[model samples]
Target: MSRTSHICLMAEYNEWMNARLYEAAINLPIEKLNANRKAFFGSILGTLNHLVVADTIWLKRFAAHPANYVALDMIRDLPTPTSLDQMLFTDIQSLSEHRKSLDQAIIEWVHSIDEHDLDYVLSYSNMKGIPAQKNFFSLVMHFFNHQTHHRGQATTLLSQAGVDVGVTDLLALIPNETVA
Candidate 1:
């Protein structure tokens, strides 16, 4: 698949998985969602909030890219997350709303760029203010991979709590190909 096509696929998968997870997560009581499960982020709600924080941070960074992506203009108005673990929302409902918005922005942002845009080396600093330069396409891959990693933790947590986000697989979203 072409680079842009791959990115667009990932973006779509990101939104689909998020919707499935959130739909299941919303059924849990507030206390259950907030209970510490000893996972990386400590609780289902905590993990979900971390995803929002991380996505926001990355989107903000991407906005600084030289292409001047119009799709990322909304990200400029989001509050900059001060820490990776920062809880942007206290409840799943509020967090899920923000997640939907971010997912939409991701889809639009991916569609806004072409294969050429992915070749540019994006310069951005870590949250600690340390600067680094990296290929834009690779960074975008990392963005999607990061979400999958944390969502795995979340799904495990939900399973422990008896909520199943069925078929959490990117392969499920991939289209079949026919030989010519």
Candidate 2:
């Protein structure tokens, strides 16, 4: 598969996994969801919130690319997250809704990206205010990878709380194309 095709797959996978994650998370007691189990970000809700914050920050940065992708134009008005650990939503419902919106935006943005645009270098400041320039394609890959990493943590947290997010695998989404 081409890089763009792989990214499109990741985008769809991101949305699917998030839907399952939120569904399982909402089944847990609100107190349990918010309970601090000493996980990275302190609780299930906190980690989930961090994912949203990170996506918002990265999407806003991608919107700054010179190619001017129309799909990312909507992100221009959205506020940049000041920190990765910022809590934008306190409850599961609000967080789930926002996650759906952000996932859709990600899917749209990835579809809008083409071969040449992937070669453009993106310059942006990190949360710590340090500046860096990196290949746009690699950053997009990291964007999806970052989500998967934290969602793995969330799956563990839920499992510890007696909930299971079934089929957390991107392989399940890949179609089987027979070769002659």
Candidate 3:
């Protein structure tokens, strides 16, 4: 499989994991979901909101690339997240709804990428206004990696609340090797 294929797989994995996480989150009591767990984002809902914010920020930045990908065209109208910890949705239902749409957008955006596009260097400023230049593919990798990292924290938070987000392994999406 190629790098583009791997990114697509990761996008699908992201959607799959997010669905499970939201289902688990909704099943729990609202108070429990909102209760302060002392996690980085403070609570389950907070962390989920953070995920959406971060995705929005990165997707908007990716739209700045010269490729003019139609997949990212929708991102142009959306408001840019001003901070990593911004809470765009206070409730799980609203958050989950936007998450579903955003995940679909992510899959579409990644699908629009080609090997040549990935090799292009993307220059963007961080949330702190620190500018940097790097390979677009590496940034894309970090995009997915950032999601996985936060999702891991969310899984832990869910576990602490006695909610289980099962089968998070990326291997679940990988095809079995053929024997020669």
Lowest summed lDDT over 10 consecutive residues: which window, candidate 1? 113-122
Report the C-alpha lDDT of model 3 over 13-61, residue by residue, as the tens digit.
9999999899989878888888899998989998999999999999998
Residue-wise C-alpha lDDT for candidate 1, range 36-140, written one tens digit per residue:
999999999999999999999999999999899999999999889999899889989889999999999999999998889899999999998999999999999
Question: Best TM-score goes to which candidate?
Answer: 1
Clashing pairs in 3: none
Global Cα lDDT for candidate 2: 0.91
Clashing pairs in 2: none
User: How do all models score by TM-score?
Assistant: 0.99, 0.97, 0.97
lDDT score of residue 118 within candidate 3: 92
Counted clashes in each candidate structure: 0, 0, 0
RMSD values, in order shown: 0.6, 0.9, 0.9
lDDT of 1 at 8: 95
Residue 112 of model 1, lDDT score? 94
Alpha carbon lDDT of each predicted model: 0.95, 0.91, 0.91
Question: In candidate 2, what are the lDDT values of residues 1-180, reduced to their tens digit?
Answer: 999999999999999999999999987888999989788898999999999998999999999988788888778888888777898988899889889988888899899888889999899999888999999999999999999999999999998889989999899999999999
Candidate 3 regions off by >4 Å?
none
Superior by lDDT: candidate 1 or candidate 3: 1
Candidate 1 yields a Cα-based lDDT of: 0.95
